[model samples]
Structures are given as structure tokens and as C-alpha cells.
Target: MSSTTRRRFQHPAALIGAAVLAASITACGSSDTTSATSPATSAPAPASASAAAGVLTVRDPWVKAADKGMTAAFATIVNDGDTDVTITGVSTDVSRAEIHEMAMADGKMTMRQKQGGVVVAARSQVALEPGGDHLMLMDLTRPVRAGDQLDVTLTFADGRTQTFTTVAKPFTGAQESYAPGHGASPAS
Candidate 1:
């Protein structure tokens, strides 16, 4: 572990989404119910500029817990430096990591692979939301349920691995409510 300890993060998205889901968390960082997620983890802990002598801020981390073979993760990668941070991979206690993207095809909702990568601009942030982008948790070794705290370590392009803590929450919207780009459809 780096000399820097973990500190409280208040990212823009976390501040905004916290109001909506804060009540859903049962305990301090545990979710009140099972939610939806991406594949497995993010990537393979790649080298990143985000990596510093301090702890990287990964906020709003959420994943779903079903008996299914798939899951997703969402969070904000905040860099406390001036270099552009590229998140190469993500990891969890469940399974390996892979980058995924949700796309609507011919009236059918599907999530596929993201070949390139997800980038967090220098001195900026990146958010993983429902309709936008996220990390996929695949081939779960076990079922992640409510009240579970997911330990995710993100790798940057600079050979730095930053571990973050994410609290699970019940996915608020309907199963088919149409998120915009991902699975959410029937836009009204």
C-alpha cells in the first residue's frame, strides 16, 4: 500500500447521484438491494498517469448481484495530478476484467466489447453511468449481493494500480426503462 491512506471522495457524479441512491444503501457503504453492473472488472491494472504517491479516487462504484454470468461496475476515476490518466484495466474479487459497452441493435439491447480503452483526461475525471460507459464484471466466482462492498483496483497507463472502494446499491430504474444508449429503450 502506498504511504497515502484512503480519503473521502466527493466527485461530481457522486455528489449528484448520491442524493438518488444514498437512501438505497443499507449500512455505511452497503447497498440495500441487488443492482445491475457491467462485465467483470475494468482492465488488467495497466500503467496510468493517474497513479501518484497518493490514493486515487474511485467514487460511485456499483455492481449487480444475480445468479447470472454477467455483472457491471461504475465509478469515477479522479486524478490528483496534471497528467492525462488512461485506465487500462480493472479488477475485483469475483473474476477477470474486461471493457464493455452497451449498444442497442435492431430493437434488441446488447453489450459488447470496447477494443480501444476508456480514458480519463488529465486533471479531469471520467464517469461510468448506465447509458454512457462502464466496466463489465464477467464470470463471477460467486454471487455478489446487497451489503457487499466491491474492492476494485484500477490500472493506469503509467504502471500504477489504484484500488478503490465501491458500495452496492439497488438499481433504481426499471429493467427495460431505456437508459438511452445501453439497455434502456422506448424513449418517451
Candidate 2:
């Protein structure tokens, strides 16, 4: 056999030795639940009070102000429970708010509503950022101005709900910037 081919094979004794070594390593690392001398594992950190909502936590929710018709809200939702949490719907003090996602389709920027829901996996987080997953507020009852606070409620799959006081901040970022002439003007 060629040296390269021979190098890939090991003797029977070597294989058996490797197997035994692997098993010993695994056993050494295994946690023995019944062992009296075993130290207890630390519990997970508690969720912050301002963010905790049922098993989900919301952080830094804010809405972008537009010059008229629509705007978007962004936040970080963290799932702290053992099971996944899905955001079913959103309610705002506006005409309508819907969960939406923005993506590049055929080289064009396209925005679409999310029919199912936004899922935050167990022990994980989902961020509703400007140009990505976001909450679209349409038919605004009033203009969202900088320094204004709005109430927003999030409905979850497990019948739990969370309400956040989102602040309106003037942002010049590209991620969630409104289209030209899309921002609504203030009524007289």
C-alpha cells in the first residue's frame, strides 16, 4: 500500500486503546446526579424588572418618527423560559400596527408582513431592528414626534401580553428611514 494510504490505518491494539481512552474521558466529564459530594450548579440570572413580561423580556423599545403616514417600532425581545415564545400580534395607539420584515428580493428592497409570528427561541433573543424585523405602524392617528412616548402592547402565543412605553426618537439612519414623501405632515 502507498505510504499515504497506510498512514490512514491503525493497528487493532491502537484502535482498542483509543476507544478506552475516549470512554474514560467521557466518564470523567459526566455529571453524577446521585453523588452526594457533587456541587450544585448555579441557577440562571433573573430577568430585569423593566423588561420582564411573563417568560419574555423586552428591552429598549423605541419608535421612529416620520414626517406622516407610517412609522416603525424596534426592540429586543428575550425568551427566558424553557419553551420558545412567539409574538403573535402588536397593539399601538395608532390606526394599525403589524409585524413586518424587510429583505432584498430580486435586488430590490421589499417589505412584507409576517403572517405567523416572531419567535424568540428559549434562552435566546430576537431584535426588531430598523431594516430587519420590525413593527409597522400604519394610518397613524397622530404624528410621532421626537420626545413623544407611545404605548405598545405585544400579544404572545401563550396568551401572555406585554406593554411597553416606546419613545419617539429622530433617527437619520438608513435601516428604517421612511421613503421620500412618505412621512405625513401635521394637520392644521
Candidate 3:
């Protein structure tokens, strides 16, 4: 990886904070009566055919509402497993999705396709939010407005796919400009 890319991964404190938040959300939302000491040992599993059931949980997922062009999705992806997992790609019916990272380019923060993939350390988590790593949704098929629900699927390096739903919300932040051929400017 380049020096700039390496620097982006230097923020351990942020990753840790995201992990803590994800764990708290999982604990609060779970219905299992099992003790905390008896944690599940299996590897991260894909969501079941019915609901979003798996060892990897996406907490508080939401997409930026946009009428056209591009927007992004943010969430805290928690991996409850003994080994690390890499998010290789993302897919949504509404638009094309790519794992993107915001980094300095030409003296300004630019958004581009992330090299390799997003790695969630074992028993840890990663946050996909504005001004950081996010899922870029381009070429929208239709308008995504407030209160709309989007079905997104995350593809893992190991070929396992986890499907989740992210609600569209009105967000004025991260108003970066997007050009069709050129990359995103002034990334948020």
C-alpha cells in the first residue's frame, strides 16, 4: 500500500471506539438469555434466508437521501468471530456500490475506491460513516428519499455474503461534489 493509505489505518482509537459502540448495540438488541462469558465461537456467518441473522451485525445502518447522482451509506459493522473478515464488495438493487475510502490526494481529501478491502479485526468492528470509509452508491436507478429502505448485500473475501437493510435519511453533511469521469472532490 502507498504511504497515504497506510496512514489512514493508523487511527486505532477510532476503530476501537466504533467496536465498543457496536458491541453495546449488539448487547442491547440481542434477545438471547445466554451469559456474556459464554460467547459464540463460530466464525462470522451469513445472514439467514429470513432475517438479518448472523455473527456479523450491521448496527444503525442508514443511507444519505438523494434524488439522483450519487450518495453513500454508513454503518457500524461488528464482527463477532475468532478471526478477521474482509468486506470485498457491496451490492444494492438501487445502484452500483463500491467500498470507498476518503484520503488526501493532490493536497485535498478525495474519495476513491479502497485498495484491498475493509478488514474488521477479530472480535472487533469498523465504522463506515461520513468523512471516513463508506459504501459509495453511484448511478441511482431511482430517487432515494427519506424513509426509504434499501436492501444491501456485503460480499466478503471468503465468498460469504451478508444482506442487510439500510434506511434512507436526510443528511446535509458530506456534501462532496461528484463528476462522472473525475473522482469525488472535497470528500467529507
Whole-model Cα lDDT of every candidate shown, in order: 0.57, 0.67, 0.73
Compared with the true structure, what per-residue lDDT tens digits does model 3 show for residues 100-146?
98898898787888978799998898989877899999889999987
Any runs in candidate 3 off by more than 4 Å, and if so which?
Answer: 1-52, 177-188
Candidate 2 stretches greater than 4 Å from native? 1-53, 179-188
Model 2 lDDT per residue over 1-188, tens place: 89866776657668767656654553354332423322122221112224222456666566776657788888777777788888988889774888888766577676767768899999898989876888888778888877677788889887888876766766656644444233222211
What TM-score does candidate 3 reach?
0.69
Kindly list the per-residue Cα lDDT of model 1 for residues 51-88, writing each as its tens digit. Answer: 32234545446665544455677766666667667777
As a whole number from 0 to 100, the lDDT of residue 7 in candidate 1 is 36
Best by lDDT: 3
| Poorest stretch of ten by lDDT in candidate 3 | 39-48
Best by TM-score: 3
Residue 123 deviation, candidate 2, in Å? 0.3
RMSD of candidate 3 to true structure, Å: 16.9
Evaluation by lDDT, superior candidate among 2 and 3: 3
